[model samples]
Every structure is written in C-alpha cells, then in structure tokens.
Target: MGVTYRRILLKLSGEALMGELSYGVDPAVVHGIAEEVAELVNEGIEVAIVVGGGNIFRGMMGAAAGMERATADYIGMIATVMNAMTLQDALERIGIPTRVQTAIAMQEVAEPYIRRRAIRHLEKGRVVVFGAGSGNPFFTTDTTASLRAAEINAEVLFKATKVDGVYDSDPKKNPDAKRFKSLTYSHVLQQDLKVMDSTAIALCKDNDIPIIVFDLSVRGNIKRAVAGESIGTIVGGFCEVC
Candidate 1:
C-alpha cells in the first residue's frame, strides 16, 4: 500500500504513555507503540514525535494552586523530557534509531533543537522525538506539534489521544455524543470542539497541515493512519471515517 504521508509528526500526550497506570510511562504500552512505529519506518514513512507532559505534571494545575506560572511551566517541560527519553529508549531497543531533541536545551541528555538538523535527521530516516513544549511558558504541546510539523515540512500531524476522535460532547460522560469523522480547522475553532487549543488549530490552518485525531489505545492504529486508513477524525481534510 502507498503511504499517505511521506513525513508526519505525531503528537503523543503524556497521558497516552500512562496506559493502564495512574501515572508515568508504561513499558509495555510504549514498546507496543514503538513496534507499530517501526512498521511505518519499514514502509518508508518518516516520523517525528512531540510528547506532552500532563501525565507527570500540568503547568495549569500548578498555576491554579498558587505556584508561579513560568516556574510551573518549566517543570512541566522537564516532565516532557523524561517522557521523551522513555520513548526514545523503547524505540531504540526495537532497533529504530531515534533522537530526543529538547527545546529547553538539556545538552547532556539530548540534542538542542535546531530546525535544519531536525529536517536532516528526518531525511536520513531517523525518528526525531521533540520534547519540552516549544521552550515557552504559555505554549501547549499541541502548538509545539504544529510548529514542528511546519518546520519539518511534514504533510500531516497525527494526534494520538485517549479519545478516538473529536466528539460533540464528552464521550465518556455522554454516550449519545457524536464523533466527527472529518472536520475543518475553521469549524473546530469557531465551534470550540476541543480537537486542540485555538493556537494549535490556527497554526495548522495557516500552514495547511492536516491533524489526524485518533485513539492510541487501539493496537496497530499508527500504521493504519500512515496507510491512509480512516481510523479517526481527519481535520483539514475530506473523507468519512469507516
């Protein structure tokens, strides 16, 4: 089968790494994800990843509880580094050459974020895992994913979340909630559908990067998405999901 996106950026929430655990990364879950990613690599798809930090710490939660916002965000960025390292380890264990690049500059552990170098890595078929949420206090990992996808010239962005797709209401709370098979970025922003933050959605809208929102819990879903299968909601594109 032909690959739909030759180069794509995957946005993995820290919560996605939690799996059945209440907190932190799950080795089995991560390994399974790596194996699936390896299949994409075998199919000649270039992958870059941007991981979130909510599983360990959320900056907004700290800010809500009286901590300084910037400090809390910095701590949250560090949490993403830990998650990225864990993912890198899993990918490498399975023979996928991976690099963890942090925006905040922890040179001893990982490489500093350099746009050209990142693109070169992708061109060489190495999976580049981006961490630290754009090295800014206010930006979310969603925005980071958009930014990186644009920088790397990625054709699409895959948002792997706990939910299968963007729903009209909370799926868990409301079983009658309808899942959107496809969405436009403008509609997502205007309707406040929560596919991503407004900033994230706006960036993709401006750059023309399609964001695929899918459930990470489903096995082999990553490869399916790469093969252009309709396993989730496709934002900024047309085509109903099966």
Candidate 2:
C-alpha cells in the first residue's frame, strides 16, 4: 500500500503514557506504542512526536493552588523531559533511533530545540520527539504540536487523545455527547467547540496544515491515521473548506 503521509507530527499526552497504574510512565504501554511507531517507520513514514506533561506535572493544578504560573510551567516542562526520556528508552530498546529534543535546552540529556537539526533528523528517518511545550508559559502542548508540525513542514498534525474525536460534549461525563466524524476549523471556532485551544487551531489554519484528532487507546490507530484512513476529526485543511 502507498504511504499517505510523507511525514506526520504526533501529539501524545502525558496521560497517554499512564497505563494501568495511577501515575508515571507505564513501560508496557510505552513499549506497545513504540512498536506501533516502528511499524510506521518500516512503512517509510517520517514521524515526529510532541508529548504532554499532565501525567507527571499538572501546572494548572499548581497554579490553581496559587503557585507562581511561570515556575509551575517550568516544572511542567521538566516533567515532559522525564516522560520523553522514558519513551526514548522504550523506543531504543526496540531498535528505533529516536532523538528527544527539548525546547528548554537540557543539553546533557537531549538536544536543544533546533529546527534545522530536527528537519535533518526527519529526513534521515529518525523519530524526533519534541518535549517541553514550546519552552514558554501559558502555551499548551496542543499549540506546541502545531508549532513543531509547521517548523518541520509535516503534512499533518495527528493529536492522540483519550477521546476518539471532537465531541459536542465530554463523552465520559455526558453519555449523550455526540462524536463528530469530521469538523472544519471554522465550524469548531464558530461553535466554540473545545477541539483544541484557539491558538492551536489558528496556527494550523494559518500554516495550512490539518489536525487529526483520534483516540490513541485504540490499537493501531496511529498507523491508520498516518496511512490516511479517515479515523478521526480532520480540521484546518482544503477538505474543511469543501
């Protein structure tokens, strides 16, 4: 089968790394994900990932308790580094050459954020995992995924979340929440749907890259998304205008 995406950016939430256990990285869960990613590599798709830090450090939680926002965000960034390292270890164990690039400049552990080097890694078929949420406070990892996708010139941004697609309401909390098979960014914005933070959708719209929202829990979903089967809500592209 022909590869649908030459290159794709996957946004994995830190919560995705948590498996059966309550907190932290679950090795089995991560290894399973790495194996699935390896299959995509074997299929010749260039993959870069941006992972969230909510599983380890919820900056919003700290801020809600009246802590300084910037300091809490820095802690959150460090949490992402920890998650990236764990995922890097799992990927390497399975023979995938992966690089963890952090925006916060942790030179001893991983490469600092450099767009040229990152693009070069993708060209060379290495998985570049971006961590640290754009190295700025008040920016969510969703926005980071869009930024990195644009910087790397990836064709699409694949956001992996607990939900299968953007819904009219929280499916977990609302039994009657309707799942959107597809959605345009304009409709998402006009209706004030929580598909993503406004900043993320705006960046993708400006850059002309689409975002695919899918449930990461479903087995082989990532591969399916990269292979161009309509697995989730597609936003911010030509089809959206159509």
Candidate 3:
C-alpha cells in the first residue's frame, strides 16, 4: 500500500507518556508508542518527533506559582529532554535506530539540534527525536514541531493528541461536540479551537504544511494517519468544513 506522506513531524504531548499514571512516564506506554513508531520506520517512512513536557513539569504552571518564567521554561525544556531519552531507550530496545537532538546543548545526553544533521539522520533511516522545545522561553512544543517540520520539509505535521479529532467544543466536556474532518487555518485561528497554539498554527499556515490532529492513544492509529486513512481532522490546505 502507498503511504500518504513521505516524511512527517509527529508532535506528542508529555501527558501521552503518562498512561494511567498521574505523573512521570509509564514504561508500558512508552514501549507501545515505540513499537508503533518502529513499524512506521520499517515501512520506509521518515519520522521525526517533537515531544512535550507537561507531564514532568509545565512552565506556565511554575510561573503562575511564582517561579521566574524563564527558569520555569528552562526546567520544562529539560523535562522534554528526559522524555526524549526515555523514548530513545524504548525505540533502541526494539532495534529501531534513533537519535535524540536537543535545542539546548546537552552533549553528555543528546546532540545539539542541527537542521542539516537532523535531515541527514532521517536520510539514513534513523528516527530523530527533537527535544528542548526550541531552547527558548515563552514558546510551546507545538511551535517547535511546526518550525522543525518546515526545516525538514516534512510533508505533514501530525499532532498526536488524546482526542480523535478537533471538535467544535471540548468532546470530553460536551458529548454533543462536533468533530471536524477538515478545517482551514483561518477557521482554527478565528474559532480559537486550541488544537495548536496560534504561533504554531501560523507557522504551519505560512509554510503551507498540513496538520493532522489524531488520537494517538489508539494502537495503529499513527500508521493509519500516515496512510491517509481519513482517521482525523486535517487542517490547512484547501479543505474547509462547511
């Protein structure tokens, strides 16, 4: 079967790694995700991931609690690095070649993020995991995913979320919420859907990159999304929900 996208940047929230736990990563969840990603790599798909740090520590929450915003954000970035390492370990245990690149220089643990080097790693069939959230304060991991996707010229940006797709309202809170199969960048911005931050959405819109928001909790969903099986809400491009 033919795949829909040749290369993609997958965005995973730290919470996704938490599984049923209230905090920290669940080994079972990480292993499961690694298996799925390994399957994609084996299928000849170029996959790069940008993981979030909300499970370990959220910068915003720290700042609200009186920590300096920059300090809090830096801590959050370190948390992402930790998650990246954990994911790398899982992928390697399954014999999937992987690299951990961080926006911040952590030579002892991960290589400093280099666009050219990252692309080269992908060309070599190694899954590149980008960590540290752009190495900047006040920027979300979503923005990091968008920027990296454009840099790598990925065909699509896959936002792996807990939800099945983007909805008109919170699906968890409102059972009657309508899920959108497709939407325009403008509609997402105007409606404030919270699918991705405004900066991340704008970056994708500017680069003309398509964003697919799908449920990552479901096993095999990632592969289905990569195969263009119409499993989630696709944003950007000419598609519009009327």
lDDT of each: 0.92, 0.88, 0.95
Tens digits of per-residue lDDT, candidate 3, 23-58, equal: 999999999999999999999999999999999999
Highest lDDT: which candidate?
Answer: 3
Poorly placed runs, candidate 1 (over 4 Å): 238-242
The CA root-mean-square deviation of candidate 2, after full C-alpha superposition on the true structure, stands at 1.7
Off by over 4 Å in 2: 237-242
**Over the stretch 1-242, how does candidate 1's per-residue lDDT look in tens digits?**
66788999999999999898998888899998899888888778999999999999999999999999999999999999999999999999989999999999999999999999999998888999999989999889999999999999999999999888899899999989999989888789888888989999999999999999999999988888888998889999763432
By summed lDDT, the worst window of 10 consecutive residues in model 3 runs over: 233-242
Which model is ahead, 1 or 2, in terms of TM-score? 1
How does each model score on TM-score?
Answer: 0.97, 0.95, 0.98
Compare candidates 1 and 2 on lDDT and give the better one.
1
Off by over 4 Å in 3: 238-242
> CA RMSD for every model?
1.9, 1.7, 0.9
Worst 10 residues of 1 by lDDT: 233-242
Q: Per-residue lDDT for 1-242 in model 2, tens only?
A: 45788899999999999976788888888998999898988778899999999889988898999999898998998999899888888888889899999999899999999999999998888899998989999888889999999999999999898888888888889999877777777888888788779989989989988889998989999988887898878886443323
User: How does residue 133 of candidate 2 score in lDDT?
Assistant: 86
